[model samples]
Target chain A: MPYVTVKMLEGRTEEQKRDLCEKVTKAVSETTGAPEENVVVFIEEMSKNHYAVAGKRFSDQ
Target chain B: MPYVTVKMLEGRTEEQKRDLCEKVTKAVSETTGAPEENVVVFIEEMSKNHYAVAGKRFSDQ
Candidate 1:
């Protein structure tokens, strides 16, 4: 079982999340040969203060 | 690239998070032979309402 997680900023609407879950499930199923129903997709939202890039937090930038 | 993510229920303090990151980074580095600096660890905190088990959200339980 492959669990796909999408991590991004916390500004997406409910509809966007639903669409993302559906699309990611389909893609993962197609590529990995897993059943669409068995493909689990997790959405993780991070705040600017908790997210960092290039050794600097997004909030700091 | 071995990117490790820890997902759990929220409410941990900053100190706990810092310790977790340090430990996870060291563990991944030792096991994967990746340098400590090269190991990236991401902590994802999920709310009870958003988390589910056996088709029932934790909040619903």
Candidate 2:
């Protein structure tokens, strides 16, 4: 399976994030024909101060 | 740069998620000394019916 990383603003329940990981793992497993366990998913939560785009901070956008 | 994917239950401002993409891109660039433009990130949203783990559906868990 392909390595996956999820970046987002933090605020979701653990259950929701966990579900995401599972689903993504399954999708990669099915699409790539790789073992589910081999698929690695990384989650990163960003704060407003840490992200920027289009010459402005994400929180400001 | 490494390929990244973010999997989560849907419901975030586009700005918030876009900021995430930028931050992660920067982080990977800084850490690996890769070109920022070379990094790729994918975002996937999951529904309750699509994800499961630990012998239970994600929504059930």
Candidate 3:
């Protein structure tokens, strides 16, 4: 089985996430020769405060 | 700043995940020319049953 995970900042529309999942699953299946039935995709959304960059939190960015 | 998130199956050792986070952060920093201090990485583990592909759950795969 081929499992894929995507992590991004919170706030994208559900439609965007759905599209991303579908596209990523398709791409991984094609690239890895994994069965479409064996491809699993998961998404995680990080809050602005929980994420940071350049010594500042995402909320500050 | 760049924030990176990784989602994967729940069984990887903490050390493995740490390595992956480091490698991915490095890769993104190099490719995007983002500073190392600007990179933030988060990992989320999905239970096998919480992820699926085609018509089957990852646990079934």
Candidate 4:
């Protein structure tokens, strides 16, 4: 029942996302003792404008 | 790194998100002893079709 989410900037290819989901599911399942089939992975992509650091938006920098 | 994410249906206004970020940052900073500036919060919005529960997507229901 472990749901893992990977958040990063948008632009990865579909193949890379597929590989990431597979690898992350396997790693999470192995480490947390959850079944591979039960591990859920979510990918979140953020545009530069919506991201920030040190009180400054990425788009401003 | 205590990176916090809020995933939900995509309908909220920008003001609500701003409020959420502020409250979440304060709460996390207070509980985890991390400075407010160091606590990063990410908002993830999903359409109905992208969300699922009990193996059925919300759009299908």
Candidate 5:
């Protein structure tokens, strides 16, 4: 089973998230040959302060 | 780049999580040859209701 996770900022619409889950599940299943149901996708949302790049947080930018 | 994630219950202490991040980073770096700093470790906490096995959720058990 291939478990996919998409981590990004916490500002997506519910419909966008629903579409993402469906499309991501399909893509993962197609590429990894895992069944659609067996492929679990978790969406993790992080706050800007908790996320950083190059030692500077997104909230600071 | 190598990214390590430890997905489990949400009851570990801060000390335990700190140790986990350090050890996991080392392990991933050694095995994947990625720098320790580049080896990002994200700790994901899942609720019992959100996780299930064999159609039975942990909260129900």
Candidate 6:
């Protein structure tokens, strides 16, 4: 089973997330050859203060 | 690029998360030989209401 997760900033509409889940599931299934039903997609939203890159928090930028 | 994600219920302290990241990174490196610095560990905390198993939400249980 190929479990895919998309982590990004919060505030996306429900419809956007639904589309993302569908598109990402298809992509993963196509590339990995996992069945569409077995490929689980998780969406994780993070606040700016909780996300950091290169030792710099996004909220600080 | 071996990226490991530890998804669990929220409310873990910062210290706990830091330790989890370190340990998980070490495990991934030992198993996959991805360098410690190159192995990224992401801690995703989800609320009970947001998590579901077998089509049943944790909050519902």
Highest-scoring model, lDDT: 4
Please identify which of the two predictions, 2 or 4, would achieve the higher DockQ against the true structure: 4
**TM-score versus the correct structure, for each prediction:** 0.53, 0.49, 0.53, 0.57, 0.54, 0.51
Tens-place lDDT digits, model 1, residues A1-61:
7888888889999999999999889888999899998888888788755543322345555
Clashing pairs in 2: A5-B5, A6-B6
Question: Residue pairs in steric clash, candidate 1?
Answer: none
> Per-model C-alpha lDDT, please?
0.75, 0.65, 0.74, 0.79, 0.74, 0.74
> Which candidate do you rate higher for DockQ, 4 or 6?
4
RMSD (CA, Å), each prediction: 6.3, 14.9, 10.6, 5.9, 6.6, 6.6
What number of backbone clashes does candidate 5 have, counting pairs of residues 3 or more apart or in separate chains?
A: 0
Put down candidate 5 lDDT per residue, A1-61, tens digits, no spaces.
Answer: 6888899889999999999999999999898888998988899897654443322345555
Q: How well is candidate 1 docked (DockQ)?
A: 0.12
- Minimum summed lDDT over a 10-residue window in model 6 chain A is located at A49-58
Give the per-residue lDDT of model 5 (tens digit) for B1-61: 4655567888876656666666777777787787776766666778899999999999999
Top-TM-score structure, candidate number? 4
True contacts kept of each: 0.00, 0.13, 0.30, 0.09, 0.00, 0.00
The DockQ of each candidate is 0.12, 0.08, 0.17, 0.20, 0.09, 0.11
Q: Which pairs in model 4 have colliding backbones?
A: none
DockQ winner between candidates 4 and 5: 4
Q: What's the residue-level lDDT of B16 in candidate 1?
A: 72
DockQ agreement of candidate 4 with the native complex: 0.20
TM-score of chain B of each: 0.88, 0.80, 0.89, 0.89, 0.90, 0.83
**Which candidate has the highest DockQ of all?**
4
Cα lDDT of model 2 by residue, B12-46, tens digit: 56766676567656655554445778778777777
Predicted candidate 4 versus true structure: per-residue lDDT over B19-50, tens digit per residue:
67668778888889987778777777889999
lDDT of 3 by residue, B1-61 (tens): 5767567778876556556666777788889998878787766668999998898998887
Backbone clash pairs for candidate 5 read: none
